[model samples]
Target: MKIGIISDIHGNSEAINSVLKNIKEVDEFICLGDIVGYGADPNYCIEKIKDIKCRCIGGNHDFAVAGKVNINYFNYAARSAILWTSLPLKKENLNFLSNLKRRIELEDNVFAVHGSPQDPLLEYILDKDTASFIFSKFNFKICFVGHSHLAGCFSFSENNNQVNYMNFSNGGCIEINTNKRYIINCGSVGQPRDGNPKASYGIYDLKNKAVNIYRVSYPINLTKSKIINAGLPRSLADRLSYGR
Candidate 1:
């Protein structure tokens, strides 16, 4: 099965729409969350995801927007977006955000989470040590996570019991090793922080055992203008162009 994985789409409907247009012909879509925070058009983004029939998990931002969690935990820009999102989501959209799970186990033995497996709404497994620790806790051959908005993959091989980080620039297909395990971050659909600034997402083919990360261009200025027009914080709009 080919699954299109997306996460951290913080309400830039333009970027999300652009990414969706490129990823044609996938069996299923899996969203790792943050559908409503840090940008404009929270309701529109959530509606788009639902239209695409994506299997989603609630992100920290999603929880905050739903009033299930406190917004004090977020930063100034994120908190602003959260406050904005809380006002606009309708009853059905709010329930959709509320009903999302923190994690999902795909049929192909891959586990998906908005954040780390250890702490779904909090911890980020960035380094090898943290990745190794999380790998030890889960027996799945592959675990996909997103929160930091950086696209990368870490593989732990049982042969040497070592963890290795794969480079995105290589552009090679990653074969899931049955004896080993992997933690893959598909990056953000609306905001990317890995310095490239383009919208990042990936397609995973379980049958071919290959994963390909793709970056697509979007109208940053258009999204920025939307953020400013929505009365969201200007800093949030500024960051999208720089990808910081």
Candidate 2:
């Protein structure tokens, strides 16, 4: 089962469209969430994902737009985006976001969540201890997560009882080892903060037992212009280029 895993789309249809073009062969599509948030075209992104019936969990932004979460939890800019995003969304899309699960566990024991499984919609597993804690919480060997907008993988070695974290900033991959456990972050599509500025996503190859992180250079300016045109913060437009 070749799975196309995408996350943190943040309403950038340009990025989503570009990313989808690169992975058309995958048998299944799994979206780790944030289908709408900090860019333009929220409705399009939502409709696009629904068109494919993407297996997606609810992201913080998604919940915020659906009024399931308080905007107080987000920064002012994000809160503004969410508030603005809510205004134009169709009732069906709002219901769609509302129906999204906080976490999804595939039959093969693959877990997908907007954040870490421990806190599904909020925790940022950025260090070893966090990773260790999350790995301990889930019995599954591999879990795919979004939310920090950083593309990377965390590996736990039972022999040493240690967990290590590294970024796939340069677009690297891991040859999945069944004897070990993994926490893979699929990064952000709409807004990438890995310092590379490229759109990031992942591929999970079930037959070969491997996970690959891939990057594509989308039209950042187009998204930037859209953000600016929509009256979103300039900082939001600026960050897309810096990937900070």
Candidate 3:
């Protein structure tokens, strides 16, 4: 099965639209959450995801918008954006966000979560120590997550019990070593923070046991204009091009 993995689509419909156009042949889509927040067009983006019927989970932003979590931990801009996103959302979309799960297991061995396994909706696995700890907490061979909005992989080799962190390369394809376990960050759809301006996504080919990362350039100006017009923080609009 070929699965398209997307996450942190924080309401930027343009970015997600570009990604959908780029990768259209996937068998199933696994969304890792943050379906709304930080950008404009929350309803539009939510509808797009709903139309596809992608398996999704609640993100921190999603929780905040759904009033499921406190926005106290968020910074000024993020808090402001979440507040802006909370209003004007459709009832169905709000319910979808409200009912989203934190984590899921697919294909028997593949685990999916919005955040780290240790803390499904919040903690980020940035370093080897955290990654090592996560490896011990989950029993799956392959774990996929999003939230950091950075595209990459962390692999723990069973042979040496050593770990390696690899950034996505050109063409963005990584060979999956079934003998070892891996934790992959599918990156962000609406807001990418990997220093790359393009939107990021991933494809997991279960048949080949390989993961392919992808990035698509969308109309940043369009989303930015929408954000500004929506009365959201201008910083929210400005950040799209910078990918901060």
Candidate 4:
């Protein structure tokens, strides 16, 4: 079976549509949250996820918009976007965000979380120390996460007692090693932040025991226009071009 992995889709319909269009066929989709936050089409994005029945977790932005997280915790631009996104959401869509779990365990010893396993919606496992520590917190052979919006992989080898990081910002593939545990970030489908403006996603081929990261271009100007038209923070729209 093949699973399409997506994360940090901050309400950019253009990005999500482009990603969905570009990824190869899969048996399922697993979203790492932030379905609505920084962009303009929160409802549309949520609806698309719902339509595909993607198994998703709640992101910090999603929690903030759902009133689960303190709005004050976010920075100015993110706070403004969250407040603006909350106003027009339908009742059911709000419920969807409100009810998302912090983590989900899938078949084949795979785990999914919005951030790190220790603090699913808050902590970031970006560096070596954190990745090493996080490796001790989960028992899954493969953990998929996305909160930092950077696409990458961190692997811990039991035999060598070593941890290695590989940047997948430009896209790459890896053959799963049975002796190593992995923490994979699928990157941001909407608001990529690894200095790449293109939308990013990942594919996990269970049968083949391999993972592929990919990046695709989308209609950025269109999403930017929507963000500006919605009266959201201009920086939110501007950041899409730089992916930072």
In every candidate, how many clashes are there?
Answer: 0, 0, 0, 0
Q: What is the lDDT of candidate 1?
A: 0.87
lDDT tens digits by residue: candidate 3, 1-244:
8999999999999999999999977999989999888888899988998899898889999999889889998999899989888779889889989998888777888889988887889999888889998888777788898989888899999999898998762237778886799999978989888788789999999899899998889999999999899898898898888887
Clashing pairs in 2: none
Off by over 4 Å in 3: 169-171
Between candidates 3 and 4, name the one with more favorable lDDT: 4
Model 1, 1-244: lDDT tens digits are 8999999999989899999999977999999989889888888999999999999999999988888878898898888889888887899999999888999888656889988888898788779999988878877788889898888899999999999997553234677777788999878889888777788888989888878888888999999998999899999999888877
TM-score attained by model 4: 0.98
Candidate 4: segments with Cα more than 4 A from true spot: none
Residue 160 Cα positional deviation in candidate 3, in Å, after optimal superposition: 0.9
Model 4 lDDT tens row, 1-244: 9999999999999999999999878999999999999899999999999999999899999999989999988899999989989999999999999999898877768889998888889999889899998888777899999999999999999998799999999999988998999999989999999999999999999999999999999999999999999999899889889989
Winning model by lDDT = 4
Reference-based lDDT, residue 172, model 3: 76
Question: What is candidate 3's TM-score against the reference?
Answer: 0.97
| Comparing 2 and 3 on lDDT, the stronger one | 2
> What TM-score quantifies how close candidate 2 is to the native fold?
0.97
List the candidate 2 regions with Cα displacement exceeding 4 Å: none
- Determine the backbone clash count of candidate 2: 0
